[model samples]
Target chain A: MALSTSSAITLNINGEKHTLPVDHRTTLLDALREHLDLTGTKKGCDQGQCGACTVLIDGRRAVSCLQLAIASEGRVITTIEGVADGERLHPVQQAFLDLDGYQCGYCTPGQICSAIAMIEEHAAGWPSAATADVRPEAGAPPLTADEIRERMSGNLCRCGAYVSIVQAVAQAAEAEAAQTPTTARQFSGPSGPGDLAHPAGTTDAEMTA
Target chain B: MREFGYQRVFDVPGAVARLGADPDARYLGGGTNLVDLMKAGVERPALLIDVRELPLDGIETTDDGGLRIGATVTNSDLAAHPEVRRRYPALAQAVLAGASGQLRNMATVGGNLLQRTRCGYFADLAKPCNKRVPGSGCPAIEGEHHNHAILGASEHCVAIHPSDMGVALAAFDAVISYETADGPGELPLAEFYLPVGDTPHLETALPSGALITGVTLPPTPVAAVSRYRKVRERASYAFAIGSIAAALDVQDGVVREVRLALGAVASRPWRAQEAERVLTGGPASADAFAAAADAELAAAKTLPHNGYKVTLMRNLVVAMLTELTEEAAR
Candidate 1:
């Protein structure tokens, strides 16, 4: 007997239950954009090469194009549409708007989603290839331009808006850090102690002034 | 994409049983490569058993202070694990040096180790690839052959393994744990990947219906100070043209112990055992490092387009060893 190829799966996306009948071959990106009408998550490369289809699956950023809709049934998915608090824009979105972090804005949703998780990963002391030290004792590396570029390398901007994107990500990271002040989470950065919380090219004096 | 049945399995035995029942069912993990292959029409499995939710997603310590990493453990979690970062720095570095953060968050350890080559010919259905379709023909041998293999390749195939984590695992002597139809089994990382003699299609020695459960990393003290360096076209998000994974244990200016492996050079991770043999008990100097690298790469047979890999591998070995030596001094 042939098994059923399509099923009605309820996906927990953006704190709402989305029950949709989809073919087994339908990717999560297609389901969100076409079926559920959540076009905030863009699809650049149907393959995994481009990160324009990035979303947060269970609090971690992942490319949705490679994920099948049926497989994402029980997972908690967060898209760019759910990033804001009703009308209040997320800090990442606000930073991007303020700093012109995008040119064509095709990759904005993915860039914002990736930057949001990256800040949290950095706060949790996850080291990147650009980090000077990978030891636990090193705490978190200072969020430098090089570090932002490395962490957000997945989401590509075809319009060459990397300079502003890097600046916007840095600003959002600092804004989030200011809201939640933790002591042990201090970064024993490569630079002096004065540049501990501040990102590279932005000084403590500038932040205060 | 073709229609396929998707089933999510919760246990290892059930997964194995289901796969054994179907003749063309594939075990999907992260779907980073498999889904792409399906989209490209390279793979068309009738049923895809989703093993991501299986109970094989833990990284625990063994009685011998070694680490047993579950197959479903994501690359991001593996790279961020405290024990992995402190004990097996090279493994973590290798994982971090690979694909972007999004891919790593979804990619599993077993999937990364089992991923296929990124050869254009292999992915192109129109082109003839010996690995993709045995006995067809290898177009890459004469066209765009610069990134082909430099060692352990035949006229049949010349595609290099596109895994940075496997290089470090090869250096540390990792063991692959799997559950077969008969019973559970283990294969050392060295023997897990079969040699590319005549058949490039048969990549691993894994049984027909075996399911990889986890990877057991033996306790090696030298691993604490190891490093993985990949030379890619870009600084990140690109496959390696040449890479090295090295761990050096120097005592009083002499090479007490060393572990070495080269990536993107052959069908499998090229463990530099000959280099280790030459570096043992020798002075930890630049000259000694260079000589040891040459010794390991002496038997390398390279194609006309890939001859530069021999030099690239040699320089990478020396440079990584020298950097480790300097760090050991301080």
Candidate 2:
């Protein structure tokens, strides 16, 4: 069904189309947790200062708390609840679990989602300011402790799980690179890199299949 | 307390229109800077006009070999642009040195330019601040002026402009474009900001109901050899205690044209014009650099809590200019 702007906006949350009426001031974080009951995305500061509310929009990691519901209309969103399959966790999620990447786990959802997006960003040859050289060779540059800290500076764990969280992101990036083909994960938008487009909500049956 | 209004505009005209229509409205760019202030109760705008969707996100080269940067351009984009990185390394370096990756992704150039004073009293509305509430009196002047201004300070207020990008742009002789309810006008970056000369509340010279459209850079030969040096309490995500953005054009070991500016030491982006005058036609030497920096700091009025800024800023200015001159020699 075609979605109108003024009426209830449809969101492609974790590949499922969820339509709900929302005020223009409502944040994506508030909408997910308060409206749809997708509480996996935590709200740390609710002002975008903390990355505890991080999620992926169109495959790039973004702070959901800062985004207005009207602005996120028809965008492809991936949250913590959608990261794992029916019974299996994503390799990053499993690695975080194995490495004890978090304590208290309040910031785990954001960390995991941000880590997944970070891996994709590095794979696409996007270099961080700390990236030693703009262009590393075809082989993946091992995410050193320093590189991990710099890349994940946005995600703060009051519980001090940084050392292990960095380890988990690095481990996941390395493991994921060894499995998925580079072409399979590249993000293609409506036109190009920063273009914005409204995608008609996909049916629930097609998404789940 | 939780109730607020949000409106997204598609163009600069729309944003200005909304803002003019309601005096209680505030323009929201990336929301990295303003949202934090709102949550902290530092800001209380009744309406938020979202300018993120505005068609002002381009970074392009202007005619006559200069650069024109849109106000809504992200900090990350400004830092990573090849032209900006290669030509204006100091600006690129300063932008990269500020905030973290996530913040850089979400901070807009306009909001960065318009960022309020980072005074502790100003941030906490509970405390008294001349900037936050004019005539409320400044507590930092006698309390903890460690992070306060040492240069261009008035008896009324001495809060500093806490933007790394602004300092670099001032040294590079950039210009700010503004579109108001009437029309458009452009002002050199150095003149865009007003000092705390009694009226501490009035910051930028942007006309009432005017929106910053973009910032323009005048291409300078010194840009290739420029560098930004910043010293802070921490390695990242902290405001600079002392920072220098220096660009030098040297010919045969003699300084020809030098543009120098100091950050975190003054009420505005403190351009060291006197320093530049002294450095011009002088050989690039430690003695020359030190004398020039000293000349600029001579006018600085340091309070008891901020006397350290005089020495730190002096040393920083000398070091930054020295390093840029050395880079040109290389």
Candidate 3:
């Protein structure tokens, strides 16, 4: 009912700089959805109890609903919309699509963003409650099913899509592991039976050569 | 939410000055709890001084083998720090046991200590909560109070402090460092919180415009044998119904020393000083643990719906002490 003072601030969202005027009481979630039209991040509960408004600030996952827009100045903001490489979907997104990780899809955006950061955190050897050894031997901690479930406990699925969601994360982790060789043997030689085996379209002479 | 002035301070002195100028203004940390309260209409600050970027985000060890944690250090960073996990495992476990991963990444140590009670009546603006409005009356004393306090509660209010970090700090005898308009000072974590007497609104002993710089945790001999056990309704991402943070020291199968603190069952993190007294120089066994728990919880008064917390707190204390003794054996 009363006129509120607004402040002009610049936000770096998804690699682009946008300067806009936002109310002093506006949250990062409201600023992204209402002002900037980045509606990919959904708002289930305005309170910090729900994880539907999760986003990445400086590559770390945080609930945007509780973060004031003015307080988030100078930090790189990454929402669900900025997760992909242009047209190509991120590996986690692709896995979610292939594994049917959503039903009504209301919490999909937050889940995807959280999963991306979750994988990176695990790769950096961050320990979760399920981890028995808080300080494990060097390198990435194994993405066990319990560990994934515990790490992803913040994001909730009302449609009971948790099974599919965990499956998607596990598959994406496998894909990422295969892409990046962690051990020396993977780069030295092919130890598996499928290595050096010719494809169906390859000729015998081509295979031999 | 109402419109308020926002000011970002880059130094401690500037923050203290801005807050001192306006009595109605409040310091903004990570905004995890303050913003939520603002949205619920429970907190209406005329001005918010942002102190998240005041260059207090480091965790370093003191010369005496203790840890000096900056105020703005994120919960996730503090829990994931190698020294914290190694030296004060109970503190790290307590931080991780609270909230979710997303919330932890945004919450700060200073804000966590200063967090208000999570009672439903306190958050409901329409309800008659004395904590929100003085002389309004505490509806939780007679209403749905399954999570209300069971210890150190006066007739005015019975809300519990909803912070796992405070419990761990109480067990470690941590000290809080702060800067005021006059000068900088420190207080023991136990003495920082004021008892909920007639005025539940005045939660802390902090003066107006006092900026919390950091907390210093003194090194303890039972660091490796300490543990935090939380009993909640759900498995993860839920508030504790009752919790315990304990550090046990055993010698020759006898209890040499012990420190205990309880959470979610008291107005503040109830330091079990009586329990520690009972455990010292006693045999390290289940019977001794039960006796200690009984001594600590002898003064607890429970509401209708929160009577279960007494049993829950006693069991948690015994279980945690037993686990620590077993760990020491190994």
Candidate 4:
């Protein structure tokens, strides 16, 4: 049988399931913006180079412009529109708002989403290019301005609002750390083992087949 | 982007068979590079075999005490792996030095190794690029080519492979494992990337319709003290203008063993065997490091704009090796 070019796939976005028929060529960014009217996820370069289309997929930051709509099924996706807890703004967003983290605000959504995940990744002890020591025992590096700049390098602001962006991210990271001392826990992979696409008990033969 | 079919498989052998049955199919890992190219009209596959769900996202130890990383392992996970950071610090640092946090979260190790060059001519359909078009001629050789290759490049193409992970892998003597219709096969990382003689379009030695399963790093004691240094236009989120991945083992003021690899200097991650040959069993001095670097660049040929790369590469090799030597001493 010839394969169909379109399929009715279900995408779990923002803790909600949306079933729709999408063309195979449609990227997840397009599906969210054009198909589902979730335009909070902006498209800057329409490529992976710019992180304007950044979203949290399986609790990690990823550019949606490069993800195929059909291939992203069965994954939990969170966009900027769903970032708030009903009326409460996320600490990252609140910091950005209070600090004027953006000028034009075109890249703010992406920056916000990216910062949320970036803080988690930093707290998890994942080293960045700015990291001096990569030894696992060295523990998580301090969340300084340089660290925030390196971790959030993907998002570009035409307004050159990087100064305030860095400040906002640093404040947010500090707030999060203060809330939970365990936030800077030693880097274990992702919290839940089941979050990864690969399940445990996979055979070696299959892994290296 | 053009329309294509998507097939996600949980098994490696079945995925290989599905791709083998279709001549124009391409296995999709993270889609960071492939999808971007498809949108740019560079790659137009009829079918995209989604291998992300395959049981190949593992990082395990081999019986020989080496590290084996599954092909579908994301760059973020790979860099964060405790074993990778402690045993092969250069590999972890290389991945972190690559693209941004979002791209790293989406890019797979296999896809990162197979990404095409970032030459403007290759992506611009209006321009002539030998790597994109077999005989279109390399415009980057004359046009804006400050980042072009200086070593192991022909008139056909001057584009450099823009992979930081591949550079570290080359230094550690990585071996690629793939599954084909015929069965399983292994190719050393040295032989994986084909030389850009006349066919810059033909990149890898992997057989047509074969699926890369994983990459294995042979146990190299020197890698434990290795480092990856990249010099780019910016402090972050930029491709390397010149980079080095060097691992050193120094004992009693003598170089016991060393591994050197250069990135953004050639069509592939250049394993600097000449430098290794010169440094092994030699006095562990900064001058010795410079001499080994010079020996490695003896065969380097440069274009008008890319002439700076030769000197840049020499400095990188020296800086990386000298730093690794000191770190090893510490």
Candidate 5:
């Protein structure tokens, strides 16, 4: 028998606070789908092999199934359900639809989440091995097919939507770079699954600062 | 699914305290390797010590003109560091050739170095593997051994270390630093991994209750000319068939100095001492390179199903050294 928890962890999910008594070993994917009923993030492989359980923590995409629920306490988590603004889908989602990036919708949520994070990472001047030049000051190189493949290598799709997924990410990168102002772009800390949280004993205001 | 324990420490002292409290504790960093193994039922530790919150996440230049990469530094951050790519191209290349962007973002330096072997028999508990269970006979000896080691093989174990970063670090004379119950110290890369002589289960030479703190690589002029060549079944996300990390200094077509190491063909990162000896006083040519490869691989003992790895290692050595030679000439 699994032990029940009396202490509840408060998580900021999609801009709302959720307090639930979750098992220590229960994964974030289980917490979201089974506990909170947020089921947009699919679980293809309980292990980290498949990218179907992808979600954005803060702003970076991470494999939710591999992460423990308690490990993500007090962090901002954005699921596929909260990726859009009201009725409009995220830019990556729109790009995926425009490019037919998915044959089966089972992997679409993961693809969109991963693509969104991929573009944000590239725009921040992070370089993958396939990035012809890894210099950060090189400044917005064209997202070629090889570069896209290398950056998106972690997120696998059984449907082989790689070509279209690459296209969607490229389109999203172009659109996102154009929409955001220069001064507003910077990579904050712990954007992925179980990223570093503010140290204990620090007040909420101090953590926000 | 089985239930286990999880504990997250806030600082280095806190982590050490947690480990000190428990004798049989597993350190969790990034959860890229440890968590996977636990889920697969290969590893079941009663206590898990989270070291991600420790103050070891940094990549900086040492006072001695070397690089000190902290244990918690992410693989992606280490590879993407400007000084790393500029000075040690092979290290960057090897890291990039690993799993993928998302994995690199999570895998840490210490975790990658301490990862266990990836033999089919080792992962499958049903199969007999001395590495997984000491004194158990190796089924891979007569079974399907396509991905097993060819160079270093005992009568008991044939698994290969599945880490590209460790191979590259071996080539550059990197040193591993760890803290034990008696305090902290460092050891050369070559002396870190123990051979699978009588006990295939014991992989590293670290004493009980020791934690890897950081890896330091001394500055070398030959670092700027280094390169990593990996020949895998696929273009990405696969283990190497036979990988070579070569660093050479060639001036006017003559070899000045060279360091070479092999992967996927040995129990540990096989440093090509004989190959380095053969290249010391000669011009960079196919003949000299082939002779060097032959000298290093001459003592290789292939298993029943892995004789092809001999040819793979020979070809990789020649091709990698030749490529480094050409680059140095330019």
Candidate 6:
């Protein structure tokens, strides 16, 4: 057996840049878990069938297993690790905990990451298969049960916590809609390219309240 | 996964040149399909030319009133485009029906077009699959073939092209544009896929090192009335058992034009030209629709477990056509 050749690449993970040598065949999921040690993003299925490796690439939800680490250079990648503000939990994470959105907790990271992007997508007036009357005049589609299920169909929980997961997403959406300034401020602070600094000292209790 | 060299091509010429230079090099789009195949050990490319960053992600209107969708356009963007939703509803619906939202966001048009079969035998490394290795013998012909092809399958392979988008593209008579070492050229989507003859390994009509640039859909009024109907075991995230992409243009109780295509029933997207011919200039009635569907599926040669697909395809065609005709009447 011979050692595989490696390539030097810089990956910006969880609001920090790390330069590492990775094999050419290393997927973004492997690079995160094996190389960078960000095990928050679980690998449910090495194939793209399962969404356990879900992450935000340039603010869009993508399956990390399907993305090559070399092809993902220069993009902003937000994992489950980056969803919190210092010691503070993101609203979605708080909602998940408050609602007990997981039983086994294996698929929780992907569910949370996917739900965050799903909320932003709906708020931006994107429609899902469950969305009837997709015209703008129809207004922002409500986060109904059907809408939640359809939008989050990618992330599967074998433990059958789907009902609780949907409830958590709805709660988070409702909280975000309430425009709680402190909670909103954490997410609104510099989440684009070249913005690596995390917000300081926001707490989980403050976000939940 | 086997160790491989990677190259990122910035231009079409560079991509063609690199691919032409290396016989074992495969072009990478979103890696949603190729990576999975590589992991399965079914594909062992020595070099991968990453074409995701190429300047071919645009979705623009052609000068002739058609639409030119770049090959690299993500499935999510293509499905959600306002023009697609308004004009080509079936195409949009077909794309949405195929994959999850996250997968769609990462899958590109080119990658989706070149997606391999979901046949269990083809994906298994230990199994004998002619599609994986020519003349290795196909276990699917007698093995668990419940989801195998019902039409255009030879003795060597019974695999089906698992793309819902391909079926819709076939119905729309879309053209595939490609660039080769010589120059650029285009072929109708109907002529793009090769029949599953003795040589099951040869899938597409693309020349070696030819890079698919985009797909051009000609303007057709039938698009406004089209619908894509897929029947599967589950409500979501399941492959279609049998699907139909139908567009009916009925005027004054007469079917002025109709386009039909079947998915998950053939090795490639089966364009129902015979059905279209039967529906054109015919009465807009359930009887006529059923007759057209029967004519198209008349040649379907089904295996033991997949005999249901023939009936499923017939019902899907009739039901979609009936719905479109009634909508046009209203």
Top DockQ: which candidate number? 4
Score candidate 6 by DockQ: 0.32
lDDT for each residue of candidate 5 in B1-330, tens digit (9 for 90 to 100): 456567777766567666777775688887777777777778876677877777898888999899999999988778767678778878888888887666776789999989988888887878778888888889888887887887767888888888999889999999999887677878898998998887889989887777889999999779788888788887777788888889999888788899998888878888899899989979799999999999998998887777888888899888888888877767
Tens digits of per-residue lDDT, candidate 2, B222-242, equal 877787877888665678998
Model 1, A1-209: lDDT tens digits are 79678999999999999899999999999999999999999989889887999999988899999999999999999999999999999999999999999999999999999998888777767788877667565566788778888899999999999988988888888888787765445432212233223222434443233
Whole-model lDDT for model 2 versus the true structure?
0.79
Q: Please give the RMSD to the true structure for each candidate, in Å.
A: 3.8, 7.4, 7.5, 6.6, 7.3, 5.6
Sort every candidate by DockQ, greatest first: 4, 1, 3, 6, 5, 2
Better by TM-score, candidate 5 or 2? 5
- Name the regions of candidate 4 deviating beyond 4 angstroms: A183-209
Q: Which stretches of candidate 5 lie over 4 Å from their true place?
A: A1-7, A132-141, A181-184, A188-209
Q: Give the worst 10-residue stretch by lDDT in candidate 3 chain A.
A: A187-196
Q: Residue B252's C-alpha lDDT in candidate 4? A: 92
Candidate 1 regions exceeding 4 Å error are A183-209
lDDT on C-alpha atoms for all candidate structures: 0.89, 0.79, 0.85, 0.89, 0.79, 0.85
Per-residue alpha-carbon lDDT of candidate 4 for residues A48-144, written as tens digits (9 for 90 to 100): 8779999999889999999999999999999998899999999999999999999999999999999999988877668888889886766667766
Worst 10 residues of 3 chain B by lDDT: B78-87
lDDT of 1 by residue, B270-307 (tens): 89999999999999998999999999899888887889
lDDT tens digits by residue: candidate 3, B7-73: 8899999999889988878999888899999998898898999998889989998999999999999
lDDT of 6 at B225: 80
User: Which pairs, if any, clash in model 5?
Assistant: none
TM-score of each: 0.95, 0.86, 0.93, 0.95, 0.91, 0.92
User: In model 6, which regions exceed 4 Å deviation?
Assistant: A1-4, A132-141, A178-209
Docking class of 6: acceptable
DockQ of each: 0.46, 0.18, 0.32, 0.49, 0.23, 0.32
Question: What clash count does candidate 5 reach?
Answer: 0
| Model 3 lDDT per residue over A82-139, tens place | 9999999999999999999999999999999998887766655566776665532322
